[model samples]
Target: MTNADKKILKRLKKEDKKALTELYDSYWEILFLSSYNILKEREVCEEIIQDVFIDLWHNRAKLQIKISLKAYLYACTRYKVFAQIRKQKAIKVELFDDLKKRFQYTNPETKMMDKELVYQIEKTISTLPKKCRIVYKLSRNRQMSHKEIAEKLSISTKTVENHIGNALRVLKKSLGYTFSILFL
Candidate 1:
Protein backbone atom coordinates (compact mmCIF):
# COMPACT_ATOMS: atom_id res chain seq x y z
CA MET A 1 0.00 0.00 0.00
CA THR A 2 1.06 3.56 -0.62
CA ASN A 3 2.08 5.77 2.28
CA ALA A 4 -0.83 8.04 1.43
CA ASP A 5 -3.37 5.21 1.66
CA LYS A 6 -1.81 3.94 4.85
CA LYS A 7 -2.29 7.38 6.34
CA ILE A 8 -5.92 7.44 5.23
CA LEU A 9 -6.56 4.01 6.68
CA LYS A 10 -5.01 5.01 9.97
CA ARG A 11 -7.18 8.11 10.25
CA LEU A 12 -10.25 6.18 9.12
CA LYS A 13 -9.64 3.61 11.81
CA LYS A 14 -9.52 6.48 14.27
CA GLU A 15 -12.98 7.59 13.00
CA ASP A 16 -11.63 10.76 11.44
CA LYS A 17 -14.22 12.28 9.08
CA LYS A 18 -11.60 14.26 7.14
CA ALA A 19 -9.90 11.02 6.24
CA LEU A 20 -13.20 9.82 4.77
CA THR A 21 -13.51 13.02 2.78
CA GLU A 22 -10.02 12.52 1.45
CA LEU A 23 -10.75 8.95 0.48
CA TYR A 24 -13.96 10.00 -1.23
CA ASP A 25 -12.21 12.78 -3.12
CA SER A 26 -9.46 10.48 -4.25
CA TYR A 27 -11.58 7.49 -5.29
CA TRP A 28 -15.13 8.66 -6.11
CA GLU A 29 -14.57 9.27 -9.82
CA ILE A 30 -12.75 6.02 -10.45
CA LEU A 31 -15.30 4.07 -8.41
CA PHE A 32 -18.21 5.84 -10.09
CA LEU A 33 -16.82 5.03 -13.49
CA SER A 34 -16.23 1.41 -12.51
CA SER A 35 -19.89 0.99 -11.53
CA TYR A 36 -21.17 3.11 -14.44
CA ASN A 37 -19.26 0.97 -16.92
CA ILE A 38 -21.39 -1.97 -15.82
CA LEU A 39 -24.75 -0.34 -14.88
CA LYS A 40 -24.69 2.71 -17.19
CA GLU A 41 -26.83 4.70 -14.72
CA ARG A 42 -25.23 7.86 -13.39
CA GLU A 43 -27.47 8.40 -10.35
CA VAL A 44 -27.38 4.73 -9.42
CA CYS A 45 -23.60 4.75 -9.77
CA GLU A 46 -23.42 7.73 -7.43
CA GLU A 47 -25.61 5.99 -4.87
CA ILE A 48 -23.49 2.86 -5.09
CA ILE A 49 -20.35 4.90 -4.53
CA GLN A 50 -21.92 6.58 -1.52
CA ASP A 51 -23.04 3.23 -0.13
CA VAL A 52 -19.53 1.81 -0.45
CA PHE A 53 -18.11 4.70 1.56
CA ILE A 54 -20.88 4.54 4.13
CA ASP A 55 -20.28 0.84 4.66
CA LEU A 56 -16.54 1.48 4.83
CA TRP A 57 -17.09 3.99 7.61
CA HIS A 58 -19.58 1.79 9.43
CA ASN A 59 -17.14 -1.11 9.48
CA ARG A 60 -13.95 0.90 9.67
CA ALA A 61 -13.05 0.00 13.29
CA LYS A 62 -12.91 -3.71 12.59
CA LEU A 63 -11.91 -3.51 8.93
CA GLN A 64 -9.10 -5.75 7.80
CA ILE A 65 -7.33 -5.08 4.51
CA LYS A 66 -5.19 -7.81 3.04
CA ILE A 67 -5.16 -5.83 -0.22
CA SER A 68 -4.72 -2.19 -1.11
CA LEU A 69 -7.56 0.20 -0.17
CA LYS A 70 -8.24 0.89 -3.83
CA ALA A 71 -8.70 -2.80 -4.62
CA TYR A 72 -11.02 -3.28 -1.63
CA LEU A 73 -13.12 -0.29 -2.62
CA TYR A 74 -13.30 -1.54 -6.20
CA ALA A 75 -14.51 -4.95 -5.01
CA CYS A 76 -17.19 -3.34 -2.86
CA THR A 77 -18.33 -1.14 -5.80
CA ARG A 78 -18.54 -4.15 -8.12
CA TYR A 79 -20.59 -6.07 -5.57
CA LYS A 80 -23.03 -3.19 -5.10
CA VAL A 81 -23.40 -2.79 -8.87
CA PHE A 82 -24.27 -6.46 -9.29
CA ALA A 83 -26.76 -6.20 -6.42
CA GLN A 84 -28.40 -3.19 -8.06
CA ILE A 85 -28.70 -5.11 -11.30
CA ARG A 86 -30.36 -8.00 -9.50
CA LYS A 87 -32.76 -5.65 -7.70
CA GLN A 88 -33.73 -3.98 -10.99
CA LYS A 89 -34.31 -7.33 -12.62
CA ALA A 90 -36.50 -8.45 -9.74
CA ILE A 91 -38.55 -5.25 -10.02
CA LYS A 92 -39.05 -5.79 -13.72
CA VAL A 93 -40.16 -9.34 -13.13
CA GLU A 94 -42.64 -8.27 -10.47
CA LEU A 95 -43.98 -5.46 -12.68
CA PHE A 96 -44.53 -7.85 -15.56
CA ASP A 97 -46.32 -10.31 -13.28
CA ASP A 98 -48.53 -7.58 -11.88
CA LEU A 99 -49.52 -6.36 -15.31
CA LYS A 100 -50.29 -9.88 -16.44
CA LYS A 101 -52.57 -10.41 -13.42
CA ARG A 102 -54.50 -7.23 -14.15
CA PHE A 103 -55.33 -8.25 -17.70
CA GLN A 104 -57.87 -11.03 -17.71
CA TYR A 105 -57.90 -13.39 -20.65
CA THR A 106 -61.53 -13.36 -21.74
CA ASN A 107 -61.28 -15.33 -24.94
CA PRO A 108 -61.31 -19.14 -24.60
CA GLU A 109 -58.25 -19.58 -26.83
CA THR A 110 -56.26 -16.99 -24.89
CA LYS A 111 -57.27 -18.52 -21.58
CA MET A 112 -56.26 -22.00 -22.79
CA MET A 113 -52.92 -20.69 -23.95
CA ASP A 114 -52.41 -18.93 -20.62
CA LYS A 115 -53.17 -22.13 -18.76
CA GLU A 116 -50.61 -24.03 -20.87
CA LEU A 117 -47.98 -21.37 -20.23
CA VAL A 118 -48.66 -21.46 -16.51
CA TYR A 119 -48.36 -25.23 -16.52
CA GLN A 120 -45.03 -25.01 -18.28
CA ILE A 121 -43.85 -22.40 -15.80
CA GLU A 122 -44.84 -24.64 -12.91
CA LYS A 123 -43.03 -27.56 -14.46
CA THR A 124 -39.88 -25.54 -14.88
CA ILE A 125 -40.12 -24.28 -11.30
CA SER A 126 -40.45 -27.82 -10.05
CA THR A 127 -37.20 -28.67 -11.77
CA LEU A 128 -35.37 -26.19 -9.56
CA PRO A 129 -33.44 -27.59 -6.60
CA LYS A 130 -35.65 -28.13 -3.54
CA LYS A 131 -34.50 -25.17 -1.49
CA CYS A 132 -34.55 -22.89 -4.51
CA ARG A 133 -38.06 -24.06 -5.42
CA ILE A 134 -39.29 -23.46 -1.88
CA VAL A 135 -37.74 -20.03 -1.73
CA TYR A 136 -39.21 -19.07 -5.08
CA LYS A 137 -42.72 -20.30 -4.29
CA LEU A 138 -42.68 -18.46 -0.98
CA SER A 139 -41.64 -15.25 -2.68
CA ARG A 140 -43.96 -15.51 -5.69
CA ASN A 141 -46.97 -17.55 -4.63
CA ARG A 142 -47.12 -16.47 -1.00
CA GLN A 143 -45.81 -12.99 -1.79
CA MET A 144 -43.49 -13.26 1.19
CA SER A 145 -40.85 -10.63 1.78
CA HIS A 146 -37.23 -11.74 1.69
CA LYS A 147 -36.93 -11.19 5.42
CA GLU A 148 -40.04 -13.23 6.08
CA ILE A 149 -38.90 -16.08 3.85
CA ALA A 150 -35.46 -16.04 5.43
CA GLU A 151 -36.92 -16.23 8.92
CA LYS A 152 -39.44 -18.90 7.96
CA LEU A 153 -36.80 -20.99 6.20
CA SER A 154 -34.06 -20.24 8.75
CA ILE A 155 -31.73 -18.70 6.17
CA SER A 156 -30.24 -15.31 5.57
CA THR A 157 -31.91 -12.64 3.44
CA LYS A 158 -28.98 -12.78 1.03
CA THR A 159 -29.59 -16.49 0.53
CA VAL A 160 -33.25 -15.79 -0.18
CA GLU A 161 -32.27 -13.18 -2.77
CA ASN A 162 -29.84 -15.58 -4.42
CA HIS A 163 -32.43 -18.32 -4.68
CA ILE A 164 -34.99 -15.95 -6.21
CA GLY A 165 -32.41 -14.68 -8.70
CA ASN A 166 -31.41 -18.19 -9.62
CA ALA A 167 -35.02 -19.24 -10.08
CA LEU A 168 -35.75 -16.23 -12.31
CA ARG A 169 -32.69 -16.91 -14.46
CA VAL A 170 -33.61 -20.54 -14.95
CA LEU A 171 -37.26 -19.74 -15.71
CA LYS A 172 -36.31 -16.96 -18.11
CA LYS A 173 -33.90 -19.27 -19.92
CA SER A 174 -36.34 -22.17 -20.13
CA LEU A 175 -39.50 -20.22 -20.97
CA GLY A 176 -38.05 -17.29 -22.96
CA TYR A 177 -38.75 -13.63 -22.28
CA THR A 178 -42.43 -13.31 -23.11
CA PHE A 179 -43.57 -16.45 -21.30
CA SER A 180 -41.30 -16.06 -18.30
CA ILE A 181 -42.19 -12.42 -17.75
CA LEU A 182 -45.89 -13.07 -18.05
CA PHE A 183 -46.10 -16.23 -15.95
CA LEU A 184 -43.10 -16.11 -13.63
Candidate 2:
Protein backbone atom coordinates (compact mmCIF):
# COMPACT_ATOMS: atom_id res chain seq x y z
CA MET A 1 0.00 0.00 0.00
CA THR A 2 1.08 3.51 -0.66
CA ASN A 3 1.90 5.81 2.20
CA ALA A 4 -1.30 7.76 1.64
CA ASP A 5 -3.35 4.58 1.64
CA LYS A 6 -1.62 3.41 4.81
CA LYS A 7 -2.51 6.69 6.47
CA ILE A 8 -6.11 6.36 5.38
CA LEU A 9 -6.21 2.78 6.57
CA LYS A 10 -4.90 3.80 9.96
CA ARG A 11 -7.60 6.40 10.31
CA LEU A 12 -10.24 4.03 9.03
CA LYS A 13 -9.18 1.39 11.52
CA LYS A 14 -9.95 3.83 14.24
CA GLU A 15 -13.47 4.13 12.83
CA ASP A 16 -13.08 7.62 11.52
CA LYS A 17 -15.96 8.52 9.27
CA LYS A 18 -14.08 11.52 7.97
CA ALA A 19 -11.33 9.25 6.78
CA LEU A 20 -13.89 7.13 5.01
CA THR A 21 -15.39 10.21 3.39
CA GLU A 22 -11.95 11.38 2.36
CA LEU A 23 -11.15 7.99 0.95
CA TYR A 24 -14.33 8.07 -1.08
CA ASP A 25 -13.71 11.57 -2.33
CA SER A 26 -10.17 10.68 -3.21
CA TYR A 27 -11.04 7.61 -5.25
CA TRP A 28 -14.59 8.07 -6.48
CA GLU A 29 -13.61 9.65 -9.82
CA ILE A 30 -10.97 7.02 -10.56
CA LEU A 31 -13.34 4.19 -9.69
CA PHE A 32 -16.14 5.79 -11.69
CA LEU A 33 -13.96 6.11 -14.77
CA SER A 34 -12.83 2.51 -14.45
CA SER A 35 -16.41 1.22 -14.16
CA TYR A 36 -17.64 3.47 -16.97
CA ASN A 37 -15.00 2.10 -19.29
CA ILE A 38 -16.02 -1.46 -18.60
CA LEU A 39 -19.81 -1.07 -18.33
CA LYS A 40 -20.21 1.86 -20.74
CA GLU A 41 -22.88 3.33 -18.53
CA ARG A 42 -22.44 6.23 -16.16
CA GLU A 43 -25.25 5.28 -13.82
CA VAL A 44 -23.98 1.76 -13.40
CA CYS A 45 -20.52 3.13 -12.76
CA GLU A 46 -21.81 5.34 -9.96
CA GLU A 47 -23.79 2.51 -8.46
CA ILE A 48 -20.73 0.26 -8.53
CA ILE A 49 -18.73 2.92 -6.72
CA GLN A 50 -21.48 3.37 -4.17
CA ASP A 51 -21.60 -0.35 -3.52
CA VAL A 52 -17.85 -0.51 -3.14
CA PHE A 53 -17.95 2.21 -0.52
CA ILE A 54 -20.82 0.53 1.28
CA ASP A 55 -18.97 -2.75 1.35
CA LEU A 56 -15.79 -1.09 2.51
CA TRP A 57 -17.52 0.72 5.33
CA HIS A 58 -19.66 -2.18 6.46
CA ASN A 59 -16.77 -4.64 6.39
CA ARG A 60 -14.06 -2.27 7.55
CA ALA A 61 -13.07 -4.26 10.59
CA LYS A 62 -12.70 -7.45 8.67
CA LEU A 63 -10.80 -5.98 5.73
CA GLN A 64 -7.12 -6.68 5.54
CA ILE A 65 -5.25 -4.32 3.29
CA LYS A 66 -2.46 -5.88 1.25
CA ILE A 67 -2.64 -3.44 -1.60
CA SER A 68 -3.07 0.23 -2.25
CA LEU A 69 -6.62 1.43 -1.63
CA LYS A 70 -6.90 2.66 -5.20
CA ALA A 71 -5.85 -0.68 -6.60
CA TYR A 72 -8.19 -2.55 -4.29
CA LEU A 73 -11.16 -0.34 -5.12
CA TYR A 74 -10.45 -0.61 -8.86
CA ALA A 75 -10.26 -4.37 -8.59
CA CYS A 76 -13.55 -4.49 -6.70
CA THR A 77 -15.29 -2.28 -9.26
CA ARG A 78 -13.96 -4.38 -12.16
CA TYR A 79 -15.26 -7.56 -10.60
CA LYS A 80 -18.71 -6.12 -9.94
CA VAL A 81 -19.01 -4.75 -13.48
CA PHE A 82 -17.96 -8.08 -14.96
CA ALA A 83 -20.38 -9.93 -12.70
CA GLN A 84 -23.25 -7.74 -13.88
CA ILE A 85 -22.31 -8.39 -17.51
CA ARG A 86 -22.24 -12.12 -16.85
CA LYS A 87 -25.69 -12.00 -15.27
CA GLN A 88 -27.07 -10.15 -18.29
CA LYS A 89 -25.53 -12.68 -20.64
CA ALA A 90 -26.98 -15.56 -18.66
CA ILE A 91 -30.44 -14.00 -18.69
CA LYS A 92 -30.21 -13.46 -22.44
CA VAL A 93 -29.16 -17.07 -22.99
CA GLU A 94 -32.07 -18.34 -20.91
CA LEU A 95 -34.51 -16.13 -22.81
CA PHE A 96 -33.07 -17.30 -26.12
CA ASP A 97 -33.43 -20.94 -25.12
CA ASP A 98 -37.00 -20.37 -24.11
CA LEU A 99 -37.71 -18.75 -27.45
CA LYS A 100 -36.02 -21.58 -29.31
CA LYS A 101 -38.02 -24.18 -27.45
CA ARG A 102 -41.17 -22.26 -28.14
CA PHE A 103 -40.43 -22.35 -31.86
CA GLN A 104 -39.11 -25.92 -32.15
CA TYR A 105 -42.07 -27.78 -30.65
CA THR A 106 -45.68 -28.03 -31.68
CA ASN A 107 -46.60 -30.80 -29.24
CA PRO A 108 -49.33 -29.60 -26.93
CA GLU A 109 -47.50 -30.82 -23.84
CA THR A 110 -44.31 -28.91 -24.67
CA LYS A 111 -46.33 -25.88 -25.65
CA MET A 112 -48.07 -25.89 -22.32
CA MET A 113 -44.74 -26.11 -20.49
CA ASP A 114 -43.33 -23.21 -22.53
CA LYS A 115 -46.48 -21.21 -21.87
CA GLU A 116 -46.16 -21.84 -18.16
CA LEU A 117 -42.57 -20.62 -18.10
CA VAL A 118 -43.51 -17.50 -19.99
CA TYR A 119 -46.45 -16.92 -17.71
CA GLN A 120 -44.24 -17.27 -14.66
CA ILE A 121 -41.78 -14.74 -15.99
CA GLU A 122 -44.56 -12.36 -16.89
CA LYS A 123 -46.34 -12.84 -13.61
CA THR A 124 -43.20 -12.17 -11.60
CA ILE A 125 -42.57 -9.01 -13.62
CA SER A 126 -46.17 -7.89 -13.37
CA THR A 127 -45.93 -8.03 -9.59
CA LEU A 128 -43.39 -5.21 -9.58
CA PRO A 129 -44.54 -1.63 -9.12
CA LYS A 130 -44.75 0.37 -12.34
CA LYS A 131 -41.47 2.21 -11.89
CA CYS A 132 -39.65 -0.90 -10.73
CA ARG A 133 -40.93 -2.81 -13.73
CA ILE A 134 -39.78 -0.08 -16.10
CA VAL A 135 -36.38 0.11 -14.44
CA TYR A 136 -35.95 -3.65 -14.48
CA LYS A 137 -37.00 -3.89 -18.12
CA LEU A 138 -34.67 -1.09 -19.20
CA SER A 139 -31.75 -2.54 -17.30
CA ARG A 140 -32.27 -6.12 -18.41
CA ASN A 141 -33.65 -5.58 -21.92
CA ARG A 142 -32.00 -2.38 -23.07
CA GLN A 143 -28.77 -3.13 -21.16
CA MET A 144 -28.86 0.35 -19.76
CA SER A 145 -26.99 1.05 -16.53
CA HIS A 146 -28.62 2.52 -13.46
CA LYS A 147 -27.11 5.90 -14.33
CA GLU A 148 -28.63 5.86 -17.78
CA ILE A 149 -31.97 4.67 -16.42
CA ALA A 150 -32.01 7.37 -13.75
CA GLU A 151 -31.22 10.02 -16.30
CA LYS A 152 -33.82 8.81 -18.75
CA LEU A 153 -36.49 8.31 -16.09
CA SER A 154 -35.68 11.58 -14.23
CA ILE A 155 -34.96 9.87 -10.91
CA SER A 156 -32.05 9.57 -8.52
CA THR A 157 -29.50 6.82 -9.02
CA LYS A 158 -30.33 5.51 -5.55
CA THR A 159 -33.98 5.24 -6.52
CA VAL A 160 -33.01 3.33 -9.64
CA GLU A 161 -30.98 1.00 -7.47
CA ASN A 162 -33.82 0.53 -4.98
CA HIS A 163 -36.20 -0.37 -7.79
CA ILE A 164 -33.72 -2.89 -9.12
CA GLY A 165 -33.20 -4.40 -5.66
CA ASN A 166 -36.95 -4.70 -5.15
CA ALA A 167 -37.39 -6.26 -8.55
CA LEU A 168 -34.62 -8.79 -7.94
CA ARG A 169 -35.94 -9.69 -4.50
CA VAL A 170 -39.40 -10.29 -5.93
CA LEU A 171 -38.05 -12.33 -8.83
CA LYS A 172 -35.86 -14.40 -6.55
CA LYS A 173 -38.74 -15.14 -4.21
CA SER A 174 -41.00 -16.03 -7.11
CA LEU A 175 -38.44 -18.22 -8.88
CA GLY A 176 -36.60 -19.71 -5.91
CA TYR A 177 -38.44 -23.02 -6.02
CA THR A 178 -38.31 -23.29 -9.80
CA PHE A 179 -34.55 -22.73 -9.90
CA SER A 180 -33.78 -25.91 -7.99
CA ILE A 181 -35.98 -28.02 -10.26
CA LEU A 182 -34.65 -26.42 -13.44
CA PHE A 183 -31.02 -26.67 -12.44
CA LEU A 184 -31.11 -30.07 -10.83
Best by lDDT: 1
| Alpha-carbon deviation at 34 in model 1, angstroms | 1.0
Clash-forming residue pairs, model 2: 43-147
lDDT against the true structure, per candidate, is: 0.73, 0.68
Predicted model with the maximum TM-score: 1
Off by over 4 Å in 1: 90-184
Candidate 2 lDDT, 1-184, residue by residue in tens: 6788788878887899999999899878766765565456788778888988887787677566554465456556555765666666745544344433432243443344335544665688898999999999999778799999999999999999999888877765664422312211
Backbone clashes counted, model 2: 1
Predicted structure 2: lDDT: 0.68
Deviation of model 1 at 151, angstroms: 31
